[model samples]
Target: MTSGKPISSHLLPLDPRRRRSLAWAAGLALLFPLAW
Candidate 1:
């Protein structure tokens, strides 16, 4: 959990719109393996 904090803080500077799109892409990436 300690290592995760730095990454979360690092991404906090990004715009909300960018973050939302990034999350959507990550979700699709995760689902793609299962869908195949």
Candidate 2:
């Protein structure tokens, strides 16, 4: 979609549970690369 949605909207999803899970996943991803 060519809609000009703000990037922050995607970063912070509407679902609280999903947002928390995404934060956890993002943290794990960052840590995984460092632990490699």
Instruction: Give the number of the best model, judged by TM-score.
Output: 1
Q: All predictions: root-mean-square deviation over Cα?
A: 2.7, 5.2
TM, every model: 0.67, 0.60
Question: Which residue pairs collide in model 1, if any?
Answer: none
Residue-wise C-alpha lDDT for candidate 1, range 1-36, written one tens digit per residue: 586477567778988888778778878988999899
Tens digits of per-residue lDDT for model 2, 1-36: 643255337856567887778678878988999999
Q: Which stretches of candidate 2 lie over 4 Å from their true place?
A: 1-8, 11-13
Residue pairs clashing in model 2 are none
Clashes of 2: 0
Where in model 1 is the C-alpha error above 4 Å? 1-7
Worst 10 residues of 2 by lDDT: 2-11
